[model samples]
Target: MSLPLTRLLRKLLHVAAKPMRHAQGKDGYVIHAYRGYGSHSEAFLMGRIFRQPGSRSQLAPGAGRDLMDVGRRMLRWGKSGVEVEVALGDNRTTAITDRDGYFSVHLPLDEPLEHQGQWHTARITACPPKQPPVEGEAQVYLPPISTRLGVISDIDDTVMYTGVANKLKMLYRLFIESAERRTAFPGVAALYQALHEGDDGQQQRPLLYVSRGPWSIYEMLEVFFQHNRIPVGPILFLREWGLTLQRPLPRRSEDHKQALIEKMLGLYDEMQFLLIGDSGQHDPEVYAEVVRRYPGRICAIYIRQIGDSDSRKAELDRLGEELAALGCVMLLSTDSLDMAHHAHANGYIDAASVEMVRAEIEHQLADEPA
Candidate 1:
């Protein structure tokens, strides 16, 4: 089957598989696992348990759940003790699920997970009573020794213009628009691609994308990234919440973003990171605090300026001064071209890639409807 047709068939299967899920409530279910990453001594992985009724054939999206029969169970599913097991090459660990059915495990490897063009497989098993156990696999990522810097990026307005600050528009863009139609900032992909290929333009740097978004949209974001030609890495997202019918509106996570960044910093402690976010949210404050805590760990901070940040120029200036005192430079701009120029000038990318970034921006603008 062709690629598009294959994807369509998978979606159809998911729809067919929904009836079973609708019937199962939250019993033994498929595990929607994501890739994890870490040093040789330690590793991390995460995924959600989805109880959907269906045969194995029905759940076959690239990240689909395992096959399981959804039999009659209690009408209401309450949050309680649920355990899952994970196994790496030479390590295995178990963790319990939270209220929203999200589980994370940190594996301690006796030795380093050496660099190879291979994905470390994580075998995950979920057992809930009466129903058979469902199993799935997730991959882990680790950069090469030649990595020059690490890239930690935000997902919303920084890369794609989701208007997260505006609730209505955020939903419209997120749910209404197709991934192709969703607006990605011009040259952002090019800039990320250039950074992924470090100063030598051939080395693979560790590029981690952190999001305030929930895990429910993981597959959608994967599709968006694939469509936009952005590099795929371990997607670390905030916990899933607000899913209960009683509370339709979920609460946003507190300080998890900075906390996740700090965890990654521990992995690549000695390396410098290019922290990319937008001034539209608390990113400036969060990143500034990061520089203060891990002084010299951040080579530069690029905060995208949304429409008319001029009204808060003094605030931005104060932030710049504080970050400077901690030995971190920051740039507040509206375009990735400026970041490309800075990256090139600061030895983050080859001079030739800077032009690649500029060309991408011009091409993107030219393709846009005026």
Candidate 2:
């Protein structure tokens, strides 16, 4: 299909998915099941089912007002008090969505998934009367047996430059740009790819991306990863954009992130992680805590220094010393090439991959205006 035609079809679907005002309305909701990745002992899958306006509102100026409008629209479309069933690896479970229209199911697997980390299809069907029994498909990834380590990284400034500290520009970058136009930090794609393909150069290490964004933007972020040549993995967003019409949903940030990191640690108990994030947010603090809690479970913590702030430097320095005491190296650098070199030295990636990352950084630098 032509690009215009594809977009037109999506617009039509969005229109058709609008909520009916009546409580017993028959119009169906939309389900967005994110692609999930996990290990042999268990599999994690998550998604959202909304009343389905899908928030097609225009990106007007002013951050606070626009964000409030988006939130209201999502709340308007959330289909609360509904049950969703998930099936994978012959095990099944049912979960009822909260007022926010989000559902998650983590299933245990006694048998091993395929050794090649092949994609497995999982079925998610919304309960009766949310009908015609609307079903959504999700992809579950099982990492290869050659996996040496698992990587958990933050998305905003570490890989893609979303300017999370600047709310308006962040909103503009998210809502207005096409996926291909969204930029990944220079050299990040190459570095992530190297980490994905570990030191032996052929092993496919488990790579996961974690973000604090809402589930509504999951599809757009997947597209961004595709266009930017970043290896996509299970994207675990922190909050549900949907909410009940009668009450307000409190904003959640730091604590929720820490809990999710602990969950990941529990799931992959045998695999150590290489932590990646930027100084613009609470990554230094959150990761320092992870290093303290997990002890030797973290191989290294690489923080991308966002700006020249004495306070930021001091915090990272304090955390770096703390992490070092726990026997994990903490690196604070302004460039992905520095992380690449660290990974290479630590055997996370091979020496040749280090040169590849350096070359990519040089190429990207030359493309920028002097």
Candidate 3:
């Protein structure tokens, strides 16, 4: 569907769902705390306050259950203008939810956190009008000072087998399928694990995943990552697809991804980054822009080939050359093993870990439907 038509349909649906959203009882207000990230001196966390229909419950895997879960998630109404307090250790900060019911807390620490390279818990509380105060805990990852490289990845076709190039198929796979039924690319988990471990096989580098997906599907993606054994990062930078008159459709994918990458670069100024994405979308162009803007901060760029046409391949070849001149190597490959080999050659990952990635590839292939 065209952009305008999609926006119109969404507006219609929003209007239709207004009554259902208001029917959410007073007991349904809840705070959803997302995973956050920070350095020793500062922390950044975000979450949402929503009026949902019912409490979360576990359900058996089936098509009916999956569709129902998707429906419930989509129907959540964000409660805007609410104040949210987040406390980490002895430091505390508060942020008010915007019109979209999203809140972000940025806390500057008086005393630096320990350089343990692990996740810390933050307590979050929100008191919606006429409802009881809701409390939740969020996990914040603080990378060790010994960290060498940072990995920023695209989620759709880069890590998993979501047919993003095709809209109809992508929606079917996204909403109709259960998390257990979704598939990750072969060896992606092992490759990411090796990257997280770094060259010494013990270094604690940051692995950040970015997606153009909506925040409503955050829990589903988390479940998908856990099921595939992919290393979880501090946060999955996702977008909000709010249906408003000023902007009905989400931001352009390239803009969304580039802004997030720039944010990560700004946050980790001391750390060089590895950009992992697919050629199925505008990832190559977006990463190239990042390399051009911040030359030395990017160590390497890996573009997974997903149904690239000859024209797209030609465009990527040009981008690769441009990035190479800027001191960053861009590799366009068909499989994770190739990217693993490149990483090993560049001393980004341990040599022995290359074999581990290969073994994982073979194992994943064996489990696939032939």
Candidate 4:
């Protein structure tokens, strides 16, 4: 009788392991623990299984599976919450959370919404059924990008040359690759300081720094800027999806950047923006596409001539003219300060304010620590 009773109890425990139902939250869906009566049926939320917004969703070898794992735990946070991610399918999208745990994502509506020609919903699974079944759908919409005058700048060679491409060789010098190491173009720091940090009595404007570099470098970058007295602003970063446990989302690098710019444009509709990049790779091409797609939103394009290769410079010059035709200023300068002043005087910023900002930056540059 004792042995029979023990076996029966084991069977009961296995049956209770099943989840009662999934819970729905504000951001996305979540997994929940199964419910049991006269006992603790609280869902420990072991894990989750769902399709990402892609051709294969959770089909990829390492990429999609990791997303599924954390996505489940992300939702299983408290009792009811959403697990958010960039809108699937396209490569460039990223997900972000508002201060209140509310989240939203931006996607290129122009891209194909279907996979293999089949339309699909931005699918997400909910866990631990809510008492009233909360909706986990992301119905929040972002405004368009044509209304703001903003600038998105790069950090590596364009802002500071930390030799990002040769990561293997520069592993030892990572500490030195900071905003302090970020030698400002003669006037660049002043330009950004004035616009973002604000002048004597003027209200500061918003400046967003978007870099392809990892977030790990952000602290050093921040320290460099603060040490140099550069004005601070919202700093966006890619989630730890690739290097860490999180899998690479669709369009991990370039696409993610494009999406971020698009979202920024939508949020600040009336103002145009300035874009700063380098001639090293695809900034010209990328900025060109941005101009073509959202012509009125970009105010200027600044590319640093880090490489002395004539063929590359010529190609960049041609692209600059094309950008100029769209009312965009394309600058290739060795001086950071010159690029900043040029950006300011080209009507991107007020001249007087630029001068003031420039003076302040000069003071910082001169007062280097002993």
Give per-residue lDDT, candidate 4, residue 94.
34
Question: What are the per-residue Cα lDDT tens digits for candidate 4 across 1-370?
Answer: 5764444444333222212112221233332211110001010011222222212243443433444433543333333144433333342243333222333333444454333311123432333224332223221112122213456776666655544466532332333323343354445566676554333323334566766665434444554456555555444433333332344443455666678778766656666777777777677788888998997788777788776698888888888888888877777876666665775566455666667656755765676555
Name the weakest run of 10 consecutive residues (lDDT summed) in model 2: 15-24
Local distance difference test, each candidate: 0.72, 0.71, 0.79, 0.49
lDDT of 1 by residue, 219-311 (tens): 556655776778886555655555677767665433767887898888877678899998878888899988888877889999998874565
Per-residue alpha-carbon lDDT of candidate 3 for residues 1-370, written as tens digits (9 for 90 to 100): 9765555444334433433333342237777778999888789999888877662445554443444444665777788989898988878999999897899999886765544547898899997877678888889998887776899999988988883345455444444443334468888888999999888877778899888878765765765688778899878988778888888899888999999889888888889999999988889989999988997999999999988889888988988888877889999998999999999999999888899999988876776555
Model 1 lDDT vs. the true structure? 0.72
Q: Which candidate do you rate higher for TM-score, 1 or 3?
A: 3
Looking at candidate 4, the ten consecutive residues that score lowest on lDDT are 36-45
- TM-score, predicted candidate 1 vs. hidden true structure: 0.80
- Candidate 3 or 4, higher TM-score? 3
TM-score of each prediction = 0.80, 0.79, 0.83, 0.53
